[model samples]
Target chain A: MSAPPLLEVDHLVMNYVTEKGDVSAVEDVSFTLHQGEALGLVGESGCGKTSIAMSLLRLQAENAVFKSGEIRLNGENLLALPEDEMRRHRWKDIAMVFQGAMNAWNPVYRVGDQIREALDLHFRPRLSDAEATERISRLFEMVGLNPAMANRYPHEFSGGMRQRAVIAMALSCDPSIIIADEPTTALDVIVQDQILQELKKIQRELGMAIIYISHDIAVIAEVTDTIGIMYAGKLVELGPTVEVFARPKHPYAYLLLSSTPSVTGPRRKLAPLEGEPPNLLNPPTGCRFHPRCPFATERCSIEEPPMETIADGHRVACWNWREVPVSIAQEARP
Target chain B: MTEPLVKVDRLTKLFPVSRGMFRRPVDFIHAVDGVSFEIAPGESLGLVGESGCGKTTTGRLLVKLMEATSGQILMHDDGSMIDVAHIGSDDLRRFRRRVQMIFQDPYESMNPRRTVFDTVSEPLAVQNIGSLREREDRVAQMLQLVGLTPPNTFLFRYPHELSGGQRQRVAIARALVLDPSFVVADEPTSMLDVSIRISIMELMLELADAFDVSYLYITHDLAVARYMCDRIAVMYLGKIVELGDTEEVLSNPLHPYTRALLSAVPVPDPTYRKPPVEIKGGITKAINPPTECRFIERCPWATDVCHSTEHPPLEDKGGGHFVACHLVEKGAG
Candidate 1:
């Protein structure tokens, strides 16, 4: 058997305690990221894509509570670790590039100094200030930002440059895994493409695992090795990127792939999935996607679908996915 | 040829910059600089570019959200041609009924406290065109038109109670309640989910047909523009560098900027990836830019003439396709 995955999240369930009641955000979410591989978590907003990413880092807000789950990094159960220990593990073992990180940097300090501070905070006592500065310069170079611009304030850099600075800070400690949540959503097309390519190149050179999260299917397809489709806090479809796009098994995945207009491909009439996403507060019974899924049946509403392996490394949670013919809209392969 | 619904000529908007505590004049930010386009009756035109490229500013200008520094916005409705740029407040109010706008963010556009009925009927109320009961009837009809079935069910619901897609539908209903001849939608579906974007887009097209509305659709998404617009205008730093039939411009681009933008957009297919083009330097600052091609510094095919000369005029090539690049002008591309 292959070695254990660099990061493994098993049966994770997260809930947020509100004034009204406890709201289940992510339920029974499980996935693994191998060494030097990338996994993309994709879904519409409030679908628990961000919740799962936050669960991995233990960064959920005070209102959030993990009912049951095991977050393992390099075979060690991170969930079982103490808060102080988990804090130390963060950035050293895994780092995150947040959504809107372009504006996340401190405006008062130099961009380089902020990166250096991350390095010092994580790897202090062993790494001197001079050493941290050197690493910060190298990190900036890796992310395609000029080391000379490190002294410049956040306000001085463009949106793309600011994002690059954020990436540099994420890599300050040489973390084994990086979780990027919608890193390029706000960027222009050219800048977005450049950043995606840079991240891919950096991943190759460093041999680090990445969990890229985005709502844009095309953006996720471009960078991720494996794609995990989420809906209402459930992992609907988990499979290789090519297979998921080319031959989607789940109805939600198929609908998502077909609805989005492609920059390249023969234009077809997009048969949009009808109805809004189900309210997560009081989600639909059984399959969360059954409300909008065209192929849903009587059995689908009464009993929850089990995640079964249909092919090698491809898992789908649906009762009638087999009976449901892979529609022409989805098979418009390039 | 029939008169176009809207015509913009030499449209420009410069925002004054103040400096120091005394608030002395510093410089101007050319948000929309010498831009011009037109939408024929019942035609859809797309204005596409990167963020801060003045696509939104152009849309706002057409709707008279901000007065232009200089230009002519001539609205030809029925037979009368009214100059929108210089219209008085009273005339502006009358002009607003003919042209309306759908904002980008549905969350922020509609009032959180207002019910769906109130939100959709607000435009009719502002125009003072009907009684309260008549406005309610119109709002219900619009809700059904936008596919919010059993309009009574959603009539009293607040924005917070609806999903992103539902909120956008309500927003669209409000924009169309006035029965405007023209609508300017600024990235209307960018905030919605990918799975539901096409549904909203199709709904808009369907409504356009039913209402006989012309659209000035502004978005950064090329694929969406291709699907929605008959003609597309590629903007760069407040100037339209290319404008043509959507299929013609996309399949066979003339301008270098257009080509770069097309290549950079991420395609859904994983098997094919366009090799990244070397887009040197940063976005051209719109404030006091050099008197050259706005895309000169980053353009790979730029020559000395591109930098030292006046801004290239958008010259018509064959078949109504217009391009502003000198390379394209010389037939070198």
Candidate 2:
């Protein structure tokens, strides 16, 4: 079932050196992404989902420090590469579509010219004006945007169209993987659905892996093939999206899924997870989620649980995974 | 059967867009164009739509935050109905005690310099209902009701010290301290994290029951609306398209726009595949919108009838479900 993983993240750890103390943003988290596979990392704010994405692209902030572990893209350690070599691999091998990036464009420049700049930088041999135009047009069509709208200013395009343009720019380099961080958080539901469908279609046709980082589990459930639930910088659970949604073993994962409200289901009483997320500056000794987990015991507070494989391709890091109820999926059905 | 608590009759709000040296009114944005609805005592009604669809404007109109261009906002006071839309400034101060609003962004709503006690007690002081010590007692009681435990600890803290969820609770406390009969909560939990959002919503539901209050819960998320509202009203470009029982309207959407919206919501189940959304383009500008059906530009089932005729009026379908689309026959659903 494995033809060598396309990207491997092994025991990655990162921290931010703030004035107060060292903020452990990312703990020992590991996951592998194969070619053409889609993975979703979902959690509340400050759960380190964005931190993981930044680490993969080596785009962390100036204060961030990688304490341990390795990120291997096609068997090459991205952390060990020189600055110039890593820059080459950024948009060419792994690209990113940021959250609310539709408004990130320079208002003074034409949208097409902005994309052309990316092609001029990352695309090899330098695309001529005509070639760059042709590439941008093709990319625009791939993302379901009209090629002619490229000349319009950023303010001229609607929110949905600008998002499509951003997606086109991400694919301008034809990267192997695209890391989209909350790609549709700002758009309306109808527009978000359209953009997600476009991304899924493009992923299938172009055979590129996608790592989606989002706080909305519903958005993640719709587009991802594999789901990884992050809590306090740790991957609490990792498995096929269907399996995890149907039979969540981790306490945090179970509470989160049940807490999310849905449009098409019976009106069940949502069980809200109590207590706030633990402060990362002075994190707890054992499991980060022990303070809010319903299944936490004395041992859970003292000893951190390791990721244990329970089913094929399903792993959960919980001392009492068996105690968590498995009836949410059935209860949600009409 | 029972006397309605608040009734809105054809409420409209137009913001003029002036240009040139004279600054003449060249155009107008019909932000809330002839919207109407009623909230029965203790009933929660959800106003839902995409951005720029006039949901927030309607909420603001009800609370008198913005004056309506022309309409009647009638609220029952002491067994008599009063037109709040045109209430004089003297009467407006008294009317404010009965109607309050909880804004969307907690970060911007509360004054950072003011302590929680000052914010919550300002309403009591403005009304001159209690002395300073009594105001403190009421604020403490309200904070405890909103789940900010150890109310004394939060009374003197400024807005910046509280978390997003706590700040929202304080906002809720401020809105409900006066025992308002009606509250308009505009997307109260949109800015909070998912884990914290559910708790805040549950707290609001609990407080509504304890206070015996009616709510016009304005939000963009249909799922959240279903949880917090007893009735759901779907709004398009400055008009109400559908309104009915939340489960009934969601399960059997009569209007095409409502159907498209329900389909577009991402279901949490990975096994579920939604039907393709049969709409085109995004929400259009409301400036000088055509007199014809506002949804014609994006509606998939727009016929010549939709184009030639005036904007359809909301007609009651069977069992209180109302729809405004020309194609939806009366009592269809």
Per-residue C-alpha lDDT of model 1 across residues B1-333, encoded as one tens digit per residue: 267889999999887777767887678888888988778999999999998789998899899888889988999866898899778889878888899999999999988999999889888888888999998888999999998889999999999998888999998898899999999999999988887798999999999999999999999999999889999999999899999889888887888889889988888877776866667655767887777888887888888888778889987777878899887754422
Best by lDDT: 2
Tell me each candidate's TM-score: 0.96, 0.98
Among residues 3 or more apart in sequence or in different chains, the pairs in candidate 1 whose N, CA or C atoms overlap within 3 Å are none
Candidate 2 stretches with Cα past 4 Å from truth are A329-334
What would the per-residue lDDT of candidate 2 be over residues B228-287, giving only the tens digit for each residue? 999999999899999999999999999999999999999999999899999988999899
CAPRI-style grade of the A/B interface in model 1: medium
- Looking at model 1, how many pairs of residues clash? 0
DockQ of each: 0.77, 0.89
**Model 2 Cα lDDT, one tens digit per residue, A1-334:** 4789989999999999999999999999999999999999999899999999999999999999999999999999999998899999998999999999998999999999999999988877998889989988899999999899889899999999999999999999999999999999999999999999999999999999999999999999999999999999999999999999999999999999888998876888888889898889999878889988888899988999999999998999999999999756335312
